[model samples]
Target chain A: MPHDHDHPHSLLPPDPALRVKALETILTEKGLVDPAALDEIIDTYQNRIGPRNGARVVARMWCDPGFREEMLKDPMPRLREMGLYGRQGEHMVFVENTRDVHNVVVCTLCSCYPWPLLGIPPGWYKSDAYRARVVREPRKVLAEFGVDLPGETRVRVWDSTAEIRYLVVPQRPEGTDGMDEPDLAALVTRDSMVGTGLVPGPTP
Target chain B: MSRVHDMGGRFGDGTVAPGEDAVFAAPWHGRALALTLAAGALGHWTIDASRHARESLSPRDYARFSYYEKWLAALADMLVARGIVTEDELQAGHAAEQSSLSERALMAGSVAGVLKSGSVYDRAGPAPALVVGARVRTRRPARNTMVEGGHTRLPGYAAGATGTVVRLHGTHVFPDSNAHGLGEAPEPLYAVAFEARELWGAAAEGDEVIVDLWQSYLEPA
Candidate 1:
């Protein structure tokens, strides 16, 4: 098996952490980049924006049919209005998962994911194993992710090779009719929007 | 031609470890990502160009480097190639001289707005050639092909396969052209749906795979 990190015997820098620091130092000295800017960008993704943004969007869809229909028909404008439009998410598509269908997203060519809503993609999403195997054996891949659908449910794997980004609207769990938007959002997991994990049912 | 990054279905890739879901595995990973993005804001190269650099790595290097490592390597190469940085400066870990490009720094305050109002590739172009429900076949991969070493959005598994166009994405930037210093040359894009069997034979058990393919990659079947 190929090791994910650089080989210990390789000529490349033995310590990647130091290499990154050196790169930053040189770039900073040249005035080509600002350390403050890097921090801001990292902080934005790490703290400000994340799966919670997507969870709220998904929760709204579950509570309001009109919003869901509008979103499914034309999502970019709606997403923009909600401050969820940005880099890696300029063009968006929401693939709804229903009783008969299940949807998942992947970018085999590279790791292209929706950043504004979901933040950076998880580590596994960019793994060669997932990119290579998911397209061929999606059922098996989903099962490994602990998502097992009924045999009758059709699986649609969306390969995001172009500018279009996809988000899967997982089926709302049963017996959550009384939950409010925030409550519903709390139930939505990052994996559900990515179609790897289902939203759990309301607690007993 | 198939590249190392185009691994969609050629077996023996092993199992996916989804539990390793941290956005940044180490301190350096986040810095690598931030540095790459910050450098990218210089307008020195297009996103397609950067992607091409990453995909152009030797197979051995590509396999050994982790995801963020690839980004850093490609970013360094692009910086030197674009004359933004030099090998000496990189090696010495210091700047040799003041860069004239200082005016183009992406400031901390502007980061939010710039990221929010991202680059737009959608451009005015001719009408789409194929419509929804149109049957199409992707161009078959040849041993030596179009713009050899050029980047492509087409994955190896989908090449030469037949599928139905389920949706039209309108004309957008074609990566094949854009990645090679060619113009955007926007083309109609479509969501082509193929049964798992069509792509991987009866041994493949998935229900379907819908790929967003440019019109240039397809022809009426």
Candidate 2:
């Protein structure tokens, strides 16, 4: 199907939703795609996988320094053992959030995200605006996300490619030394894990 | 032949805002994504080939389609190009007649196993020429036989700029060559770190960006 002229671009549906629905119906009717498998995929990306998994990993690391060392040294073995494995997350690299340096992740080419750890990426994460401006004015871009840092603090953006994906491990909250792993995990937010937001203050 | 998809350190695009967590804005988006992944599991085209299909569209068309629409378009292009489906069948939403080709079905119960054991892109290749901490610059690798313009993982923003190899990711399938079934020719990949000042101008001092670049994209600065 040569897509320039024979394919009347004008004939296509302006409404994306309907176009997709029509395509899906055709593919299913043709028996090329299994309906049950499609449902499982939608459900898996929608619910089964998400930032909560990454939070658990981060919390365990914060609570157990030894685990952090092992995870930092070689995460694939430890991550697989922790059940944190999936497509787009084949080779996981955890970037630490320290007082002086903050890490932010973006896929400028086509939104290479860590689906296993962060679930499906947010719409903005894949938007033209974020992909273009974030690399140029990261501080300003981050400030729009309500993240303001001291002038002294630094930022590092990871441009993800197909070979590797990055997950930002936010710094542990202060005065959380007494908190258990679950409690510490509770403090980890999705944005924080992405290094675009601060870890929530300890609960009273 | 720079594809519009290679956007990094590109400025003046506007404000970046947080978005809703909804996986799909419409039901079709979800189905579109599922169908692409499902059909892709058939192994007719490599992931890089599929990506090149989407990126090859005229920039106007590329920007026109929504994310899932692009996915659907790429899926249609691949199916037709591979002879698995005909334009007439695609247009009619049914087979013209019985297609002899058998497509594998991924069961719901096996979704986890299938996704968990994702396709590995690494392949056998020569030893890496450079190690960590070595300074290098991105280069346009030599190509032959196909169209001069196509998809590449190398972001244009850092093509001529210099950076240091902070981490080496061993050898992996090179997407540029892999897109054309140009053998599994794996090459060492590196996490090259560029200071913000080096990428931008004095305006971006004290910041840094790290990109995962293939071995071919690098040359000693």
Candidate 3:
């Protein structure tokens, strides 16, 4: 038999809209989802929301050391208490930074991230190079991202394989002693939480 | 087929820092191809079953069942065109390798191990090195600053950042040509803690940060 070896263009296509539409049709016919509710769900998630909701909780934890400790030991209860627990993040571990070391996270297999607190990860993080090289040569990788540490400092890398996801509780920078919770929340950057870039200096 | 994960120690660089333009380029056709392949396979099986019914069953029964057969005929046509499985052997070899559960499990386990090593594909055990909390410094690579060819797990971001031993995971494994398969050594993995100040200078917050690192990625702090 002569195979029609057209090869069908490519195995992976760039256009996801057609797939999404087909899936929607299949799901509708199967009574999985009502066609009317799909648009509402996508709109609410894509536009209005932000990571600020999770950041507020972390900010509050930062202000209260006892609460911070409790949150770190068991984040689920705390997240439920704050009513910020939902979607992809069911558990969390807040890794604190001190005078001696730094923390960075990578999902060696896939982009497993703490979406509850940080929302979606940046494009650079999901790249193959970042995933492959970060665990292999963290120091050099961090330097390329403009986070240079001294030769004497020790770099520790975390490869997230299990369900336990991580968030870096960056040591609160100096000169923000009196800042309130909301203002402090503004200081927290997604990169700091991931241990890539630090929290930028307080605005001006 | 080579497992997707095993990549390491094979001596060449695979790191290609694709620019932004290339990253955003259209590449979703790959997904379509997968869907098409699946659709074609299903079509082939359906046609074979229908042909069997025609040869064995009475004309009346075949007519009764023919209405129920919708995409199977189209699927078969597509499959025949693509040469996935011939009309004669619709489902012959499908269960050949998968029939034995134990054999399948063993093959899967070995493949998983090989994929994890990020090196040449082999079914060795783990890597041997320092303990998780044992203070170990990273050995500077002798050549190729851009490439990592040493016994270290120090990530690019946490390089030079130090911390204490936290957890010991397991031994590291990589493919070994010397063993003609996968190789392993008794090495400990650790979750090292670093202070945010050390990583981000003045911009850091709180007191410390902890990272689960491997034995190969640390040096005595």
Candidate 4:
């Protein structure tokens, strides 16, 4: 490994190849990982099946009331029922969004979210600011995300600890009242079901 | 070492930076890439390794692993864009670890030992404090910002906020690192209800907003 201490003068630094190589060497020496094996694992997970599976399951739950109820009571049964059980969502709760009230879920401890339903939680949910602020000042926190609810709507913040994982079942919006299940399904955004946003119907 | 997952709720309220959630808006592949890099950096390779491997870890360990998995997945995208590491390299490393990484990976990932001796809430039994409808006041710390420090009972959003204990949900193991390991004894935790005005300003108007706060975060009004 050649050291780069002897050179410099130009404003632009060289590429980070050396640093990457060094890191790779260190990881290999420590026996922390095998580079070849790692590549295959990453390729399969990243390119193959992804959050789409979880998103579809959530979409299905949004349209099926009975399934949604089962998901709320014990998410695992319904999740397994739907073959969507795994990852961080072994235990789950589906919070229903209703008129006059909205449910926003946060893992105040460390982002214990329902990955099986909504997929991985957004980074903001795990940050110190979100975990801390959302539980206390939810309206304000929601406001920052462009999710401003009138003060009249009560914000119920669920702190997901270890035993339970939660998902927000957003209220079905008005314009989609007469729409069929599949059309209504398109209206369910992961955020809305997470209680951070509403499922707005298709543009008039 | 204190696993970040084991130290939940340690930071006092208000420390979470604004607009942090959108960072996870990337596509699933990007998120997976982020997770792999994080697992490598933290020396915890089993989180997303596979279903069987994950099941082998204890509940506490599983909790920490899950936390890291979410963190890494989100972080990988940022790392790739910043050129800290390449997508190919990150992926390759993850795959290598999958087949050959040993039990050390599991031990290296353990944060169970770092958990505090007693949890603020009892994960094992029942919460030991004010029940729903019990009158309680927010515990006013000497400094409001202290609430912003690492895991505390008080929620940053609820500091200076007051309410009646609305529900006495059964004892939940308090997530605070300082409180995680408390043995068998029950600790008081409460689900308090606060008026929207109390959390926001007077201009706010809504039915009372209910939050599940621990007993440590409250005081007698």
Candidate 5:
């Protein structure tokens, strides 16, 4: 191991992907990382956990008042019971949308979202546009997302700053009270859970 | 510390593209994420510290680096800074071919349990400085600048800004102090309500932004 380079100039690769590969190689070789563990982590975030999990919870809350009441009391334990508990979602706080009040979430400092419930955050949620303006112009931002509220419906933009990650429980649309859990879940969308867009209206 | 990552209140950030969201745009992004989290499991640094490193890149690098590039830089920086890995090894992209290190490595079967028992930061702490409905202001650095220079959770837009406490959240870790290897120093977190005008002047109207600020970031206004 005759590494004779005195100067510690950054030898990091210029290419982003290569740079990532390089670091992965180093960590794996150093026994600092496990490729198998990495795969499982990535697999979980990619396919298993995401907005659908949140949507399931949202639908359950809509159809089952008992569950909703318990969730409102504190969603963390309930989410854990449902097996939705995980990183970036250790603490849970649910904000409900009513005819009088609407809620949206952002992280002004950085992009922090409920990873277990919402899966990986969408790019827009992490983009500078959403983080900067949503706080100042919630109405405008929501409108951009095609979520227009009544003039009297007050909008509250939540900045996910601390340990608490917010899940916006949108109001269930009128009609169709007989829908089952699976159908209700289908109606719930990711943006709806995020407070950016509404759940799909009963198929026209 | 770089206000670079704090994009709140800036203008003309363009429109959010509409489409299905891909968890990771590239295989490397996933690798970058996995590497970060695996290192995180080792507990050498807090999540806030990793975030600060990712956000603390030089302005030019921060601006130009792609998302995962930033992650890569942060991971490398954290490793070197903490002496977990050396710059020489990182640069060489090859270790001295050692057999193995006895460090605690996350195993495949343990992913579910590790994530389910995610790192907890909400620890009991001192009583809250301000109560719900109390008017408060976010403190700023001595000299005024849009950005800060340390590991801070206080966003530039909210610094020195006035707001009202709408809800009292329980004690939670303060990210500002935690990023520098500072102790968790848990504090009461509050949901502070700021009218659009208060945060963005007349440029904003018709809505309010509620930020969760730790007790230390607030003072009676």
Candidate 6:
């Protein structure tokens, strides 16, 4: 394979894919990293952990009054009880979105999101546009995402600057009565838990 | 001075358009993320140090690189800076010498356990200086600049702003010190709520911004 600096000018690979390949190769040769370990890490986030884990929590909250109250007041213990704690989720906080107030989260400095609960952050969540705009004009940003709120609903933006990870518990949609846990969980979208969108009403 | 990564409240970046929802938009993205995380687990440097490397990129590069590009670039920088790899070696896409640092290699079997038990930042420290509901003011950076040669969690927009402490988060590792070679000086953390109007005056809308701030960044209002 021709190296990035094969020429006298010393140019890096123009393609990011090539650069990533080079890095993995170099790290593996140095014995600093294992390729199998890398694959395992990728598979874990890409498959096992994601918003589905968070949805189950949301559905339970809708069904059990005590669970919802405890979660809003204190989330870490409740989350730990369900074995839903890990990296990027060391310290968890639950912010409930209500009719009067809506809560959203962003990490302006870097993309600090709840990886264990929601998996890798969506591209928009990590984009510079979202980081810059959401803090200043969340109402406008939310509207762009097809989420328009009443003028009276105050918005609260949580800038995650520390180890504490926040999970926005969107209000349970109306007419969800008699639905089992899995049934209710199916309605919870990733956007609702992130506070960009709300859970929609059940289909007639 | 604030870096390009400290983009909170600044304007004209662009519109917030959603993109493909896949965890990894490309195969290389997954490889880059995994490589960064696996290398980081070798106990080479603190997570804060990694963050500083990514933020320290030139403004042009910062704007140009994608999210995972930044991660891979920062990882390479850290590897070279720590003498684990040479610039020539990186450019050549090969290692020149075997590293004696393989003792802490994150093996495949240990990957799950390592991620399962993530690094805990909480440390035993003195009681919190401020309590919930306390009125406090965030201290501005020196000469309106961030910590010289050190990293900080305090964003520029929140500098010198007055807000109420909404919640109390116990002592945790301080990024300003941890990012550098300094030890983990755990400090009391608080979720301070500042009215949108307070931070952004007339430009502000009817909303509030809550930032998790360390005790050292706050003083009695």
lDDT of 1 by residue, A51-137 (tens): 999999999999999999999998988998999989999889999999988998999989999898898999999999989988888
Quote model 3's iRMS: 15.4
The DockQ figures for the candidates are 0.56, 0.59, 0.07, 0.17, 0.59, 0.59
Once fitted onto the true fold, the runs of candidate 5 whose alpha carbons sit more than 4 angstroms away are A1-10, B97-101, B142-148, B203-206
| Residue range A2-65, candidate 3, lDDT tens digits | 2223321112112354433443333233232343344333322333334566567667877998
Cα misplacement distance, residue A47 of candidate 6 (Å): 0.7
Query: Native-vs-model 1 lDDT?
Result: 0.86
Write one digit per residue (lDDT tens) for candidate 3, span B43-143. 23332222222222233322332211212222333433445434333322121121111221112123222222212111234543555456644433311
List, residue by residue over B70-106, the lDDT tens digit for candidate 2: 7777777777778777766655555565444435656
Decoy 2 TM-score against native: 0.94
Kindly list the per-residue Cα lDDT of model 2 for residues A41-129, writing each as its tens digit: 88888778888899999999998889998877778888888787778788888989888898999888887888788888887888888
lDDT of 2 at A14: 55
- 1 or 4, which is superior by lDDT? 1
Better of 2 and 6 by TM-score: 6
Q: Which pairs of residues collide in candidate 1?
A: none
True contacts kept of 1: 0.74
| lDDT (tens digit, per residue) of candidate 6 on A1-204 | 433321211224658899888888888898888999999999999999899999999999989999999988888887777888889998889999888899999999999998878999999999888999888889999998899989989999999999999999999988988789999999999989889989998898
- Model 4, position A113, has a per-residue lDDT of 65
- Please report the TM-score between candidate 4 and the true structure: 0.57
Score each candidate by Cα lDDT: 0.86, 0.78, 0.46, 0.50, 0.79, 0.86
**How many backbone collisions does model 6 have?**
0
Candidate 4 per-residue lDDT, tens place, A1-204, comes to 222221110111122233233334434544544555444443433443334554565566667778776766666665666666554555555667777778887765445566545554566666656765565566766777677786567777766533455667777677665676666667777667666667776789
The CAPRI classification for model 1 reads as: medium
Return the TM-scores of chain A for each candidate in numbered order: 0.93, 0.93, 0.83, 0.74, 0.92, 0.92
